[model samples]
Target: MSAVIESHGHDDHHHGPAKGLTRWLYTTNHKDIGSLYLWFSFAMFLIGGVMALVIRAELFQPGMQIVEPEFYNQMLTLHGLIMVFGAVMPAFVGLANWLIPMMVGAPDMALPRMNNLSFWILPFAFFILLSSLFMEGGAPNFGWTFYAPLSTTYAPPSVTFFIFSVHIMGASSIMGSINVIVTIMNMRAPGMTLMKMPLFVWSWLITAYLLIAVMPVLAGAVTMMLMDIHFGTSFFNAAGGGDPVLFQHIFWFFGHPEVYIMILPAFGIASHIIETFSRKQLFGYSSMVWAMASIAILSFVVWAHHMFTVGLPLAAELFFMWATMLIAVPTGVKVFNWVTTMFKGSITYETPMLFAIAFVVLFTIGGFSGLMLAITPADFQYHDTYFVVAHFHYVLVPGSVFSIMAAVYYWIPKWTGNMYDERLGKLHFWLSFTGVNITFFPQHFIGLAGMPRRYPDYALQFADWNAISSVGAFLFGASQILFLFIVLKTVMGGKKATPQVWEGSRGLEWTVDSPAPYHTFTTPPKVSL
Candidate 1:
C-alpha cells in the first residue's frame, strides 16, 4: 500500500466556506461543521450563563429581587436545558468531527450527508426549546431532570414542543454517533488497529456506544411522557396504574450515563494535552482505555443512585449505593494515571496543561463528594442541596469545559496553521481558574451548611457566600469574551505552524501538513511511532 495520500477526494467536490454567511448552511466538511458546532455551543453557553447569573443575583442578598418565583423557575430550567443539550454535548461532538478524521487518517466523516443533518438538527431543536419561553404557561419549570408529574400533568403548554424537539435532538445524536463509529472503525489508516488507536479516539468510541445505547432510552422515556400527558396512559401516574417513582428510574437510567458521556471525551482531551505539555508518554495508555470502558459499563448499573431520596427499599438503596461507589474505583485509576504521567516529567505550564492539571485536582474533589453521595444515609442530607450542584459544576465546568478550552488551545495551532496569542491565552486561563474556584469552591461550604439548590432566594446565613459567588459568576461569564476574541484572532492568522504543532504531540495528525487541506490522508497515512 502506498504511504502517500494523493487522490484526496479528487472528484468529490468539497462543500465548505467559499468566503461568507452561506458557508455554515452549505458546509459538509468535518472541520467546517466542527467549527459551526463549537461556535453554536459557545453561544448557548453564554445564554445559559446569563440565566445562571440571574439565579445568583437573586440569591445574593435573598428575597426575590431580580424576578418573581415563576420567572426564577424559568431561569433555572432554561439554564439547565441550554447547558446540557446545547453546550457540553455538541462541543464534544465538534471535537470528534475535527479530530476523528485527522487522527484516523480519513479525509472526512464517513457519511457526510448524515453529518450535515446532525449539525442542522441542533438549531431547530434549540429553537423549539427556547420558543417554549413565550408560550402562555412559559418554558419548562420542572427542572432539567424533568421528573414525571412535573413534566407531564403539571408541565406548561410548552411541554408538547419540548417532547418533539427532544425526539429530534436524540435522532441527531444517534446519527452523529453512528457517523463517528463508522468513520473510526472503517476508515482508520492501515496498521491503526483498535487497541493501537490514540486514547482520544478510544474514549470517543466508547462515548459513541454510550450515546447510541442511552439516547434511545431518553427518547423512549420522553415518548412515555408525551403519551401520559395527551393519551392519558399514565406511565407515571399511580391512579392509572403506573408509578411516578418509575420515572426517576428511567430518567436516571439515561441521566447517569449522560454525565459520563459529557466527561469521557474530556478525559481523552486532557490526557493528550497532559502528555504533550509534560513531554511524556501517557501513563498506562491501555489502562486508561480500560478505565474508560469500565466507567461506561458501570454507568448503566448505577442509575438508581440518583433516586435514593424517593423512598426506595432498603435493599435497593444499599445495592445502588454499592454500585455507585464501584464507579469511583475505575475513576480513581484514571486520576492516578494522569498524575503519574505528570510525575517526574518536564512539566510546562502552558494554557492547555494548566487546564488539564486543574481538571485533575478539581474533578477528584468532585469525585470524592460523589462517593460521599453514594452512601445511602449520607445522601439524605446531600440529596437536593447545593452540594449536588457544587459537585457537578466542579466536574462539568473545570472537568469538562476546561478540557474543551484546553483542547482548543492545544489544537488551534495545527488547525489554523498559526500559533495563538500565548500571553492572552494564559490570561484567559488564570481569569477562568480564579473565577471558577471562587464561584464553586465556596458552594461546597454552603452545601455543608444546608443551603438548597434551584431556589431563587436563600436565608441571611447564606448571604455572604452567595454574594461572593455572584461576583465569581459574573467574572467567569464575562471572561469568555476574551476566549472568543482569542479564537477569532487565531483563526485569522499568526506565526506559521509546522506539521508537528507541539514538539511532543503524537499520532497521524502530525504526519499531515499544517492547516490540513480540504482533504487529508486520502490514502490513509501510516502510523510509525
Candidate 2:
C-alpha cells in the first residue's frame, strides 16, 4: 500500500501547538486531548495502585494490619472504580484519539469539541468520586459492583456522590464513543476501505458501537439506583416489591459487555504489535476481525454466567454456562492467530513485543480460568472467591494493562520523535512480568484452597499465599514507577526517530513523520492497494 499526500498550503498556517495551559484547557486538537487523557489515566493508575497496595498491605498477613475492614472495603471499591473507569478505559480512549485518526488517514476526530468535552469532564467525575472518601460515613463500601440493598439502603451518604460521578463518567464515555464512530464512519481517506483499515481501527469501531449500545444501559442502571435511594422506590429493594436480584440482572447486563469493552482493544493492540515484531503481515486478518465481532455478539448472552450462584433456574444456568463457553471459540481463534503470526517469522523481543506476547499467554490463562468459572457447578465454588479475583486480575492487569503498555512503547516514537531507553524499557517489562505473575498466580492456588475475595482478613491456611501475593503486588506496583520514569525520560530527550521507527511497522500512521505533525492528512491522502 502507498499513500499519496495531497497537501494544501493553508493547512500549514498553524502547524504548531499553542505554548501555554490554554492549549490543553480549551484546545480541540485530538492529539492534545489524547495527551490529556493519557496523562490523566496515568495519574488514576497511580492513585488506584496506591489503593491496591493498601489493600495488599492489610492482607499481607492473616489479620488486618494497616486498615480497618470498613476502610479496606472502601479501598477495594475505589480501586476497582478508578482503575476501570479512570485508568484502563481512559487509556484506550486516549489511544483511539491518537491512533485512529492517523491510522484512518483523517485530519482529526470527527467531533473535536466533543472529544475535548469527553476528556475534560473525566477529571471532574473522578474528583467527585474521590471526594466521597472524606464524606460522612466514608466512601462507597458495597464492593465495586455496588449490589442493590447495599448500594441503596446500607450505603453511606457518599453513595449519592458515587451515583452522580457515574453519571458524569457515562456521559463522557457516550460522547467519546460517538466521536469515534463518526470519525471512523465518515473520515477514512479515499480507498481506505473497511477491511483496508488497520486492525486497531477495526477494534475501536466495534468498541465504539458496543459503548453506544451499553453505556445507556449503565446510565439507566445507575439512574434506577439514584431513584431507589432518594425517591423511595423499590426498583431493587425486595422489601418494597422490588427483587434485589434485579439489580444483579441490570448491573451484569452492563457489566459483562463492559468486560469485552476493556479487552477488545487489547486484542487490537496485540494484533498490531505482534504483527510488527514478527516481521510479517498478521495471519488470518479476516478471521481475526470476524472473531472479534463474534466475541462482541456473544458477550450479551453471557451475563447470566456471573449470576449462576444467585440461584438461577437449572435451565437458565445451563444456558448461561453454554453461552459463556461459546465465547472461548472466537477468543481461541484470536489466540491461535497471534501465535500463528509469530510462527516462522523473524520475531524480535522488543519491549512492545514482550508485552504483546505476555498479553497472549496471560490473557489465555485468564480465559481458561473463565472457562472453569463458566461451568455452573464449578462457578458455585469459585464465585466471590480469590479464584474469581485471580481470574479477572490476570485478564485485566496483564491482559488490558499490559496491552496498553505495548501500545505506548510501539507508538510513543511516532508521538514524540524520540526513541525511549530500550534498556530501561526491557527492565520495566521483565520486572512487571515477574511481579504480576508472582502476585496473581499464587491466588489461583489459594482461591482453590477456599479463600474468599474482598475480605481484609483470612484463615491461617490462606495466610502464606496471601503473603506471597501481597509481596508480588508491591513489586508490581513499584515497577510502574520505573515505567513512568522511562516514559518521561523519552519525552524529555532521546535518540531521534525516523518516520518508520520500527522496520516492520505498517500502517498509514507510519507513513507520517516521526512525532506526527500537529495536523496530519490535512488534505486527505489517497490510499493505493
Candidate 3:
C-alpha cells in the first residue's frame, strides 16, 4: 500500500502544471519558459515602439516639436538598443525555446534550469538600463553603437549602468546559446540524423554557434570601456593614446555576426512556413542548409564594410567591399530556394504565408540597397545618412521581424489548442505590410537627398518626406497593438485545433495533441528518418 501511494504521488507530478504564480517562478518546463520569453519580448517591442514613435513625432516637422535635442538623442539611443537587443534577439530566442526541442524530438531543453535563469535575468538587465532615464544625468546618449570616446569620455554617468546592463544581457545570451547547442547535440531521438532535421533546427544550431563566438567580444568591448571610463585607461580615448577606430573594429566584428544571428533563425522559420502554404516540399533542402552555413562563415569577414568612410587603406577598403558583396551570393541562393519551392505548387495565402512572401520580396529589396551601400565609394556618400537607416530597417523590420510574425501565426494554434481568427490575422498582416513599406520607403529617398540620421532638426528642404515618413511610422506602431490583441485573444479561446494544425504541416511538433501535454516525449518517439 505504501508503494502504491508513492506511485500515485509520482503520477501527480507529471499530470499538468502547478497552480498559479509558482508555475512561472520555479518551472523548468520549456513551453512555459517559452511563453514567458515571448510575452517579455512583446512587452519590450511595445516599449521600443513607443520610443521610436517619439523620435518620429519629433522628426515630423523637423523642428524639434516634441523633445529637446538631448532627450531626442536619448530616445534614439534607447530605441535602437531596445529594439535590437530587447525586441529582436529575445524574440528569436523565445522561438528557439519553444520550437527547437519539439523539432528534434527531445523531452525538454538539455539545461532546463539554465533556460529559466537565462530568461529571468533579462528583465533585470533591461530594468537597470531603463532606470537610467530617471537618474540625474539622464540615460545614455552616445547612440546604440556607443563608439568609444563618445561612450566613455562624454557619456552620462549612467554609462556604467549601461555597461553593467549590457554585460547581463550578454551573459543571458551566452547561456541561452549554450543551452541550444547542447540540447541539439545531445538530445535528439533515434534516427533523427543532422541532415534530416528540420531547417529551423539547422538554422538555430548555426545561430547558437555564432552567438557563442561573438557575445564575448561584445562583453570584452564594454569591459574595456568600463576600465577606460572609471579606471583611466586609453582604450578609445585619443588623449590617452588609444585609437577610437579600433573600437569600431572590435564592435563590428561582433556587430556583423550579430546581424546574422538575428536573421538566421528567420531563414529557418520562413522555409517551414513557405513550404507549408506552398503545399510542396521545400526546394533545395541540402542547398538551404549549405547556404545558411556559408552565410554564417562569411559574416566574420565583412565587418569592415560599415567603416568604409573611416579612412582605411585602399587595399583594406577593397577587400571589405568585395567581401560584403560576396555575402549576397549565399543569401541569394536562399532566396532562390524559397521562391522555387512555390513554383508549380498549390499555394495558399494564409496569414503566415503572406508574411513569408513579404519577407522574401522586402528582404530582397533591403539586400539590393545593401549592395548599393557595399560600394566603397558610394558608402562614403551614404554613411551616417538616412539611407543607411533605411537599408537596415528594411532588413530588420520586413526581413527578421516579418519572419517572426509568420512563425507566431503559423504556430500559435498548436500552442493554444485553438485557431486564431483568420480575418483578424489577415488584417494584422496587411496593416503591418502596408505600414512597413510606407514608413521605410520614404526614408530611402530623403536619405539620398542628404538627410542625416540621429538629428533632431533638419533643413526645410528635407521637411516633406520626413513628414510622410513620420506618419507611416505611427501607422506601423499602432498596428502592433492589433497584433497584441490577436495573440491574446487566440490564447484565451478560439476554434479548437487538431494535432496536425495545418494541412501541409509536417513535424514531430505537429504529431502531439494541440496545446501539447504538460510533459512531452517522456518516452522518446521514434523518428522514421
Candidate 4:
C-alpha cells in the first residue's frame, strides 16, 4: 500500500509509528500516545474487573467465601481506586488522545513529550498503589472515596504509597488534559472553526478544563490527609478543630466533576455514532455543545448532593437539592437532542450504532436514578446503599464503557484498515448489554430494599439479587473477552477499510489514510462543507 491512500483527506507526506521503548517512553504522536493510553486502560479495566468479581463473588452467596473481611475491605478500596482513576478516567483520556487531535484536524497533541511523561507516570503510580496490597497491614482500606480520619489516623502502612501514587496519576491526567485543550485551541486545520469542530472535541475541551481545575484539588486534599496522617496537622482532625465533613466536601467537589469527566467525552462519542448511523445532521448541534458546557459548569455545584444525608443544615440541603435537580434541564436537553436527531432518519443497528443506542437508553436510566438520588429525603433511604452503586455503575459501565466500545467499533477500521467481524462484534455487544443490565438492574431493587454498599457479605434476604447480579457480572466479564478477541483479530488483519470507514461518517479523521500515515497529512484537509 502506498503511504497515501486518500478517501477522506488529502495527504502530502507520511510518517510511521514511533521506534522503540524509548519512543513509547518519549512519544508525542497523538495516535501513539493514544494507543498507549488505551492499551494501559484496558489492562487496568481487566484488573479492576477482577477485583470487582472478587467483590461480587464474596457477595454472591450470603457469607464470605473466598476473602477475609480485611482483605475484603482492601478489595473494595483498590477496586474503587483503580476503576475510577485507572479504568474510567484513562479510557476518556485515551479517547481524547485518539480523537481530539484528529477530530479537530490537529497535527498532534500540543505537548507531545510532556504527553509521554504524563502517561509514563501512570504505571509507576499504579504500581505503588497495587504494591501496597502486600505491605504489613494492607493497602488503604477506606473505600475509594477515602474520607478522612479513617484514611488519616487509622490508615495502613500503605496509605503513603496510595497518596504518592495518586499524586503522580493526577499529574499525568493534568498533562494529558492540558495537551488536549492546547491542541484543540491551537491546532485545527485551515477552515475548522470552533463550531465546525466535532462534538467529541468540544466535549473533551470542557472535560480537559474540568480535569485541570479539579485534579489539583484532589492532590491538595490528599496532601492534607497526608499531613494529618504524618505531619500531625488538623486539616481533617476533629480533635484539632478540623472537620471530617469538610473532607467529604472537598472530595466530592473533585469527585462530582470527575464523574462527568468520565462521561462527557462519551457524550461526544455517542453523539457521533448516533448521528452517523441515523444519517442525520446532529439535531441542534450547537445546542449539544451548550448542553455539555452547561453540564460541566453545573457538575461543580452538585457535589454536595452526593453528601445530602450527611445532615447538612436545612438551607444547605434545600440549595443542593434544587441545584442537583437543575442539572436535569440541560441533561434532558442532550437526551432529547439525541432522540430527535435519530428521529425521522434512516436507522441502522450496526454494532457502533447498537452501542450508541444502548448508551442513550441506559445512560438515561442512570440519569433518572441520579435525579432520584438528588432529592434530599429520598436520598436518606438510598444513600450509602447499593442503590447508589447501581446508579453509578449503570452510568459508567453502559454509560462510559459502552461508548468506548462504540468508539472502538466505529474507528477500528480507520486504524486497522480492516473490518472488525460484525458477527463477533454483535455477539460482544449483546452479551455486554445483557450482562450489564442483569448485573446492575437488580441492585437498584436491592438498594431500595436496604442493601448497604462496600460490603463483602449480605443477609440471606439480599441473597437472591446478589446471586443474580454476580452471575450477570461473570457473563459481563466473559463477554469482554469476546471484545478483546474481535479487536485483536481486526488489528491482526481483516477486509480492507475504505477511507470513509463508515458509509455515512464525515470527519477529518476519516479524511486521513487508513491505519493513518505517520506524520502524514501535515497539510490539513480543507473542510468541504
Sliding window of 10 residues with minimal summed lDDT for model 2 = 1-10
- lDDT string, candidate 4, 120-165, tens digits: 8899999999999999898889999998888988899799999999
Candidate lDDT (C-alpha), each: 0.89, 0.93, 0.93, 0.89
Q: Over all chains combined, what TM-score does candidate 2 have?
A: 0.98
Q: Mind sharing the TM-score for model 3?
A: 0.98
> Per-residue CA lDDT of candidate 1, range 282-369, in tens?
8998899999999999999999888888888999999999989998888989999999999999988988888889888988988998
Candidate 3 wrong stretches, greater than 4 Å: 1-13
TM per candidate comes to: 0.97, 0.98, 0.98, 0.96
Encode model 3's per-residue lDDT on 1-529: one tens digit a residue: 5644643454456768889999898887789998888888899999999999999999899676888999999999999999999999999999999998998998788888789999999999999999999998999998999998889889999999999999999999999999999999999988899999999999999999999999999999999999999898998888889999999999999999999998999999999999999999999999999999999999999999999988999999999999989999999999999999999889999999999999999999999999999999999999999999999999999999999999999999989999999999999999899999988999999899999999999999989988888888898999999999999999999999999999998999999999888778777889995
lDDT of 3 at 181: 96
lDDT score for residue 499 of model 4: 84
Sorted on TM-score, best first, the list reads 2, 3, 1, 4
- Candidate with more favorable, higher lDDT: 2 or 4: 2
Pairs clashing in candidate 4?
8-511, 9-511, 15-518
Error of 1 at 337 (Å): 0.9
RMSD of each: 2.9, 3.3, 2.9, 4.0
